[model samples]
Target: MSIKKNRLSQNGIYGPLTQKTLRNLLKKELITNFGFENMHIIADILIDRFLKIISECSVEKERIKPYQTIVFAVDRNQRFGYGKTMSQTKLIPVTVNIITHQELEELASGKYLKDLRPKIVTRILKEAYAQGGVLSLNDVAIICGVPNTIIKKAMRDYYKQHPDEILPHIGTIFDCGATMTHKRIIIKLYLSGLLTKEISEKTNHHPFNVDSYISSFEQVRGLYEEGKGVQQIAFFTGFSQSLVKEYIQIIKELNQLQNNNKPNGLMSLTS
Candidate 1:
């Protein structure tokens, strides 16, 4: 019987078999050796054992030193062995280079850094700004294979040196703490529906700061609906009573305008 050769090697004694052929051969062997009834159970046991062996081999392979090579001989005709007798076997020597995860990362990073040029950094920043005004230092560092600290320093230095060009692209810059505090106050008062007094007390911030934080929303009628007087709203929101009353009046006027702007037919339908 002529044996089929594997694509990897023409003269090897045992070549790789296709998944379908291997399965069919295993099924036939199990049926002949253990009968039809016991075939599936025996095959399952064999498969589980083979999988365990494969997992162990994978772990051992990982434990091997990086760049270390292992040479081994494989018998190609082992599948044709029958009843203590073996067919003419050919031994093929194979060499495998072992590489650890860290080694692979280092090699990949080296290649990335080698390919990256000074102009590429500027282009990366430009692309980042085009996508969004904000760019992540860690993301850019990962792409360029540089440390985040180095990337941040380089960006800050570049922006300072060329503010005319870089500042316009990057957009407004504010202290992170101040920006976060401003957002937190707005979210607490508006989205969270917390009282201005509650936000001021919790944040230990001035009432004026809270009012300024929520000024962007341009409305404050909910404070009045909550049964808070103008004085109380001013105390909590950091706005003067006059400002609070003014804001409430503005909100009322805006509501009245919206009501008047509705078509008479739609207003009648709702009524």
Candidate 2:
């Protein structure tokens, strides 16, 4: 979104644009088997996580963290809408009164919520635009202050428009076959420090592919192995050939620098 054409504020519970981004995040997801009760609980949890992550930064770091509070109001008052009431009793989770999928669709399409601040709507619109109009529930929830369940509800509403393609599970965007899923599982297993040929056999993908996706760091160490070219290694691994080359070159340069025992000299790597 157009984010005020300036730098974001370094301090605040959430910036106005950040809040809107969070709302868009929630709106983009499919909300299956969810209601206000669950939405409120999730919102509270996400807001707390956002606050903790935001506190660690003096300004925007090279990496950005997601915050959700600025997007959806905890209540009509647009306040934190959480913590204990003055009476010291815990407040009920805020009601997300948009009860029907139709209403959420209208809001996401910019038909509703037109009268509210543009900041309340534009960020989601921008993100949806960026993603070529297909926003997954998991991706949006990662940005919003809502729980994955609420985001799933939003996504469900959107999926109602498309009945042909088989719907994907949460957090899975790849459109490969069952074999690909199995391959992914094996890759994860290996990354968790399990090094075994059995995983490769079970997944049915070549061992080189599994190694490429799961352990680039380790793969670089094995560059001296005969009959293993980085380009061929990258092709089956699902990583770009360029990245494979970069890692290989880095390994060679690192070894050369170490052998020379130079403290400070010109390095060969461009990036």
Candidate 3:
């Protein structure tokens, strides 16, 4: 039997306006409810303006199927990733709504469209995590109110200098292998001489939290430079020994790097 390809609603030639486009639905409504016939030319003209409007607009759930879903977050103590089964860890159910008009209004404007997309990605990631959901980059991009490639390009352009910086998503938060811990990554950025506010923006953390970390690391670094032991630095700084050691190691490495970059008998000023 020959497949009836021509039986498609728009004759299968104009497939771009299939059930997916609002223009198609509006065309059907004009025909079905307004007494217009299926082949009426007025229906096409009526939908043309709306098609133009859609072409200029952005949706939060761009290129996403189903537009939303319920994703789970594992308990804090359990390792969670794509391969983990339900029985292996305690789970928290979270409703992730990708196509939120509210998010679109909060995220987009004409002049700042490029500047705000990475922030939108970060905001969506935080929103899901705040509600006990762990969204991947794909899911977060859907809520960014732009194409995923454009959103990713904005993020990459902004964060290229600090590639290992962690954002609060399952891709980074749950990946315990090569990716650095969030706090450790922040400390590394600090050691690399980034300002606290810059570090906050890059790491998707609030400035207050970033400042607190900077204060803690400064205390640890001061004691370590004075030849204090890890336990002593931890006790003095009111931080864990592991944290103190981490800071000290980063400080030593930064110092060594600075020394290595200096020419014979000349001090390096870059650090």
The list of candidate 3 runs beyond 4 A from truth reads 1-64, 67-163, 170-180, 191-193, 262-271
Off by over 4 Å in 2: 1-214, 262-271
TM-score of 2: 0.21
Better of 1 and 2 by lDDT: 1
Score each candidate by Cα lDDT. 0.46, 0.41, 0.63
Error of 2 at 205 (Å): 30
Count of clashes, each model:
4, 15, 0
Worst 10 residues of 1 by lDDT: 167-176
TM-score of every candidate relative to the true structure = 0.22, 0.21, 0.39
lDDT of 2 by residue, 1-271 (tens): 3455333434344565566765445433423324444476676566566655554322443333332212211111112113534254212221111123544566688874433212222244333423223223443455454566765555444434432222322122221222133333553355344565755444433455556445664554354244478767776565667666655654565556545764434332222
Model 2 lDDT, full chain set: 0.41
Which tens-of-lDDT digit does each residue in 2-111 have in candidate 1? Answer: 35435335534343434346455666676777575556877867866765554543536555565543222222222222232213433232323333355457667774
Ranking by lDDT: 3, 1, 2
Weakest 10 consecutive residues of candidate 2 by summed lDDT: 72-81
True lDDT of residue 207, candidate 3: 58
How many backbone clashes are present in model 2? 15
Q: By TM-score, rank the candidates, best first.
A: 3, 1, 2
Candidate No. with top lDDT = 3
